[model samples]
Target chain A: MAEDHKMTYADPWMLPETKGFWEALNDGKLVIRTCNDCGRGHHFPRAMCPHCYSSNLEWKESDGTGTIYSFTAQQVKGGGKYVYAYVEIADRVRAITNIVDCDPDALQIGQKVKAAFRPSASGQNILVFTPA
Target chain B: MTAHDARLVGAYELPYRHAPDKSLAQMQAEAALGAVADAGLSLKDVDGFFCGGDTPGMGPMSLIEYLNITPRYVDSTETGGNSYVSHVARAARAIDAGLCDVALITLAGKPRTPAKGSRPMTDSNKPDQDFELTYHPTVPANYALAAQRHMYEYGTTSEQLAWIKVAASHHAQHNPHALLKDVVTVEDVVNSPMVASPLHRFDCCVITDGGGALILAKSEIAKRLNRPSVKILGTGEAVKHQGAGDIDLTWTAGKWAAEKAWKMSGCTPDQIQYASIYDSFTITVLLEIEDLGFCKPGHGGGFVAEGNLISGKGKLPFNTDGGGLCSNHPGNRGGMTKVIEAVRQLRGEAHPAVQVPDCALALAHGTGGSLGTRHGASTLILARED
Candidate 1:
């Protein structure tokens, strides 16, 4: 019975959209997310809100500036590893990010932080944060 | 306000017990008996059963069948780990709607303690099996992805995460029923062999075998039974996703539940006297504290490391009976113990050595999985009227 089942295969990381996002990051300029409409600031680039069902949303250049609303340390090892942080930009939106190149102990809550581009484990310029 | 209309008249939960080899039915029966006695009632007094959907223990109908409960109301509400306490609000509505008078909530059995791979195999019976579990990615691995992502995005350190173990173990030292009461250090958490990358042995919650139960009835039932009434002040729920792609991972849905719960209870985070957040892992609690608005976000690691979760001097007195991380975790029934702790504190019945003073409002938060993919979360507010 087991042999009758052909193994179905899939790759988790081969996303066309993610590849495009990474390409933008490599230029040290966060991508201007292109969506159907609703031109505005989209920090974590996405084609849809999954909310208003308004696929009509476009990404623009954010100041790359925000404040650390909350964060936690992860001890479990693997790439994509660093202190996870929630950055609040433009008053209401929060994006998940990694804070790097600083003392882990020194990062504080509500401290101003800004995002910068760096080559990520995925071989793309990913936006990382540092204390402002 | 008339006593008869209050949603919660009486509630009682027994001290948690560890009995790994025993069947779920037996534990439920024992806990049910204790709850009955606490309310000055008997099994005959109970008219309903509510439990998580797929616990190894008895389901509401199965418990009714095995225990001969014969209740008119039965709830097998399974969102995830918070299922039991979530039952409280539903049971109250059921009682208010005159479906039943007393709802007996019970959970039993041991899925955590090592027993030759008794882990509930992922449900692969569905046609979507190819999409869900055919890849051999287990729950821990799903959590591992979130953990790794958190590490990548935040630069949160091993020492800070290890502090969750260090701090939880400190609270466990005072809990007589805790499975691991010996205090551990950050080194112990770091050195422990990795279960999945970024998660060490101590970072993960220990598997435990235990049973807990609670009795819930209308406000009038409290006066009639002569038991102190700890009203079910508020309850709330939030859903993230059933699959990985839908999960945001770092920003939890549980805190959203807590926010609604606080609004429903008419209480603020600072007004809560004690908290029993479900601790499947230390990170879960850390995130919860922030999301619940107890501490500013990102401050959870530092808040926990600085002895802020301890009983006497911390900014908040938390999990005085040891949390699921240190206490017994019988799958989703972990919520029962959390509510029980709140009830005890509100009734001024906790072991005097560990009890909080004048505790009128208590909060219990439950989280089901890592980064909570398919996460089910609920926050319950219980209060004692002066």
Candidate 2:
């Protein structure tokens, strides 16, 4: 079903601050930046910690497991149905990802999910989630 | 002496239709000129400007240059539909501080009639592109996520959401300029094509090519104008989140922004005779009404389900111009139109069928960006002078 659509997903435009997160994704690892000063974690990487304005940040591998906070079964204008959702990867941190490998209509809140990496139409690895 | 004393003396809505021949600049110029004329002021009296749009080469400077006005103040706060409401508050503050005397806030766009060589409407630099775009979430899908969550948490039924559309369409029937005036029902909305789960096409706002303008002046200047004026009694603005996460889906920045506006206005929710709450989506109106203290949290769906928002029904009249749901939404600046409608209602100038009798105070509120993620909320309270 995923291959039916001829859509091409391009690699994200990397900024100087976000290079590390994309590089880690390429290495088959999910990483989140943790603030050294405030002991907080964030995603879609930023240069400085959103909490406490700390520039002292460190990268750490995540378990890549989260719970579905909310989701929508989206039927695009010409595209097929897909489940888009906000999955909480850590305390107070959520990542937007697609829920693949399951009936989109069957998705429920608080459902446990795990990361699954797949090659984009352009051959760049992208992260998706599936029922754990 | 308070900054909240600014007055809106002039309001204009450009002919709401698809005029491909009219450039955005031309539409903006017409609306600006019309508003100034409505206030019985010459163009030279304008010393401040505010605008927001996504069309190429659209900004405060471009408008300033096009109008050829040397203004003492300018603002281009782009927070989607809520931008213009924020401008109203900022304009009031500027006038109160003696930074400017007459402020012209305008919005124009041609989303429905794109030119032959126009650029793609979607821009790639949006913050959500980093993550949320990868999942193929359309505007309707983003709101559907909130509707879904609201249903899960508070048992908000799809039928309840549909009632909002029905009420909007009912109001549109009286508005000659509304794009969709035919009456709609819960069945009509439920049977409409599903854009995203829990949100049908009818649940979303109509896209059109139109513009609106508002002229806010110092109370003294407004009093001298030959036209009716609405006072900016109170205003509040807030932004909770910007991207796909971090904020609660069921709640919006309106909770905080409306709280401040209510405090500053010294007016309770029941005192608001007319409301022009932004309706970028049906769920948006429900969430805002709840956050603004019009009804209890988790009870918005039921409150609206009782037909309380329908014009001439004796309840709080909302979106009396038919709202974005049925009237028009040119890009993300529906907030400007909301202000225009509220002003019209307070002045006893609205379509007679939809006008609330003896309307003394009005509220105009808007939400920008996705409800599921980070977004901006703005609320403005306006009153008619005795």
Candidate 3:
């Protein structure tokens, strides 16, 4: 059979460079931004430190652990339910992410969670926090 | 410039004329220039600048490069629609602190982007890396989810949300420049196509290219100006959460901002004769009505649906200029439009048809982003004479 002409090529610019965040996920570790100047760590990693405005920063692999700060269960029509979380990692850093591998209603604040990477569409992976 | 004794000495707003073809930058410059002229000042007097991140040239550094104005204090805070109102207070404080004598706060429409049909999703920054984008949960879907929650918790019907759009459209009928000038009924809103669950096409705000600006100066300078000074009695900003995961989507950080603004302005909810709550979605206004203490929690659906939000007989009139729901809302410019309406009502210059009767105390509020995530609210309290 001839190749279907229905397939369209994805744009080159569409690829997101998330290897840094995903690489740590593959290693069963969570990575966050740690500032050398102020000794603070943050989720949603950035090249420059937000607290001290220091460009000098390093990546610290988390203990694959954290506690839930807060969360919300979202239900979209035609889409299943899922709970998003505010997780507090080491060094007083908090991030808004998702807690997976658990029932949405069973989620609790201060629940211990560990990092896990799961395969996603397009040969990529995502970081999901599960109860430790 | 003095201490942090910031006050809104003057404000200006132009009608929301639809100009989808104009570039965002041109609209921004026009608005800024008009505001300066209205204040009887010149751009040369502007020493500080603030604007929304969505503008053509945004960020403190980027806008300065684009506008070619060397502002001592420059900020491009992007908290969505409320950014303008919050920037107003921030610029006012900057002016009072002597950081700048005249501050220019302006925002234009969202510049069109080619790749995504709209601006890339926030999570697009980490697309291959971010999981949320994979679900295709754009803002409309996010708002749809929140609207569902509101319906679940408060028995808030889709019809209730439609009432806000109906009331806003009613006001827009008198506003010649309003994009949706025709009056609509609750039935019309319900029958409209559902863009997302619980939100119809009519429930959403219109997108048009426009700009607005306000020139804030010290009291000494404002006192001598020819135009009536719309003294900024108080300004406050609050963020409920940086993202949708933190707060109860039904409640908002707007409550906190209003708490501070009302306390500082020395006014109570009962004193406010008119209000301008951002109407990105009809549900947003419903949430603000309750959050701002205008009505009890879980009563927003009733407050708006039962004709309380309409002008004249209503205890608190809202969006006399049609609002984002029925007016031309070019992204973050909605907030500035709200403030301008309040100032005009205070000055008794609102178009005769939509003018609030004897408007003495006014409240303007704005919120951006979907429910439960990164909510931004700015509340401003203004009095005719302070």
Candidate 4:
């Protein structure tokens, strides 16, 4: 994908605990942090399980198959247009992302989607989604 | 002092179109002074101060100095637009606890003004900022997410949501100072340029430069004032967020807030003649109506369709002053005006064309932040004191 197509938003201000999540995306794979203590998973890789407050967390590669929970295309006046959505991925964990390589208008809730790694403004591979 | 012992003796929404010449402080100070004088009370009478994020400088300290009045008690809770709404509960409790006799709550903002370059209020360093901001999650983006989920969940349509903006336009036509007074139609709303899918440009509220203020006094002070006082019957506030990724986007925390306010006020939805629901977007009013118990959760589409929220024409007259949708949204916050309009309805001081008949009881509610994510909800119930 061309660099100009990425969202105008700035790159992620990474933290130590969540660095591996972004690194995996750069390698064209998606990852979710899972709580070893409670068997729950979370996205955007947190230090602890938000569900159970357990610090027993580990990196787990995800197949990146998901269903679009809700989606909307933001068309900024005189600016770029992109579709951002919450896709229920990694066993129902909602991941914030954009739906790329597809028609924004054709997207629907509950539509099946798969990961598409695209270059972000900072040249990091950002994980987006497209119709599977 | 007892619960519900505070009465709104004064409320003033600056007759705002645009104030490019005014500083944020000037707007807020003028609003503060306006309410003080409206209550027939002197500036000396304000011994308590309540403010939110819109206020310039460090909390209320700078504003207190700018106003040149010393308030012995103060609260500077900043919950976006819901700050002023929640301030009402804080001010009333402070007054009841003898923290202050006369309390002044103020809000001012200039978001509509062309920016001279400034950063957002929230730092980009928040834990979730990096994760969310990169997705281009603008204000409309967040609400559009909820709007889309709502449509999918309850078979809601773009046309049904357009009715909300249509109703607001009808009421705005009666308000000369309304930012949009042309009286738009449902078709017009649905056809407006789409800024965010499930949300047309017309479905969104106008961004305007203006401010408003409120004055709450102890019941005795209110009785002494010559102005008609609106008694604060009940107040409730709640917060909502995506609970551990089990996020629900269809409804807001407004249900929880409304329930608490209803239980406190001992009043039901049937008793409210007028409503000042925050209209950040047309979809917001829809969800709020359902959450406030005006109708069941999924029935909001039908409840607002066919001109259900238009003043003097619908079952409930909402946002007669046009709300944040048509009227000015100072500081880009919608909470202060909701409280101000409710007070106007309760005092029978609203524009006569849109005023509710009898106008005995009214409700004002505010939702701050975004519906798609973490947000605060506040609700207030007020009644006329004969």
Choose 2 or 3, whichever is better by TM-score.
2
Docking class of 3: incorrect
lDDT of 4 at B262: 94
TM-score of each: 0.71, 0.94, 0.75, 0.96
Query: How well is each residue in B1-386 modelled by candidate 2, as lDDT tens digits?
Result: 23266889899998665778888888888889989998899778999888775433756887788888999898888888888899999999988889999999888888788766866644456545657676677888788888888988999988899989898898999888889989999999999988778889999999999888889999899889889888888889999873423657887899999988988888889889999988999999889989999999899988898678998893778888889999888754589889999999999998998999998899999998878766789999899877
> What TM-score, to 2 decimals, does candidate 3 have?
0.75
Against the true structure, whose DockQ is highest?
Answer: 4
RMSD of each: 8.8, 2.3, 7.4, 2.1
User: Quick one: best TM-score, which candidate?
Assistant: 4
TM-score: which is higher, 2 or 4? 4
User: Which segments of candidate 2 are over 4 A away from where they belong?
Assistant: A1-7, B1-3, B54-58, B116-128, B242-245
Q: Write the per-residue lDDT of candidate 4 for residues B1-386, one digit (tens) a residue.
A: 22478888988888886888998889898898899899999879899999997777889999999989999998999777888999999999898889999999998888767558676745656777766777778899899999999999999999999888888888888888898898888889888989989899999998888888999999988888899998888889999987656688988989999999999999999988999998999889999999999999899999999988888678988888888888777778999999898888887788899988789989999999988878899999888997
DockQ of each: 0.05, 0.58, 0.08, 0.70
Compose the digit string of candidate 4's lDDT tens values, residues A19-93: 888899888888888899989887667788988898988888889889999999888667667888999986658
Residue B300, candidate 2: C-alpha displacement in angstroms: 0.9
- Winner by TM-score between candidate 2 and candidate 1: 2
True contacts kept of each: 0.00, 0.61, 0.01, 0.76
Residue-level lDDT tens digits of model 3 in B233-266: 7777888753312235567888899988887877
